[model samples]
Target: MKAKPSLRPEDAGDRPPFGRSWGVLYVGVLLNLALLVVLFSLFSKAFR
Candidate 1:
């Protein structure tokens, strides 16, 4: 029978060189804001 290989933490890629969570959050916020603006504009134009 063949044996399964064991996994180790060291085998994983190293952590990102710099923190990345904040960048993702910032991008999400910007996208949300943009979507809100577009929605509002469309609604306003429709009402007009």
Candidate 2:
């Protein structure tokens, strides 16, 4: 089978702000967003 070209390999020249790889950075961002959503939900419930 022939290997396909992927964007990941091309991303070698771009460095993430705070991690070794782009995937780690993405996961961190997603986790942070989830935490914020949870906090906001709690805050809304507390006021209601």
Candidate 1 deviant stretches above 4 angstroms: 1-20
Among these predicted structures, which one has the highest TM-score?
2
Candidate 1 lDDT by residue in tens digits, 1-48: 999797567545543344565577678789999999999999999999
C-alpha lDDT score of every prediction, in listed order: 0.76, 0.86
Q: Please report how far candidate 2 places residue 24 from its true position, in Å.
A: 0.6
**Pairs clashing within candidate 1:** none
| lDDT, candidate 2, 1-48, per-residue tens | 998776675465787656888888899899999999999999999999
lDDT score of residue 30 within candidate 1: 96
TM-score of each: 0.56, 0.62
Question: What is the RMSD, in Å, between candidate 1 and the native fold over all Cα?
Answer: 6.8
Clashing pairs in 2: none
Q: After superposition, how far is residue 15 of candidate 2 from its true place, in Å?
A: 4.0
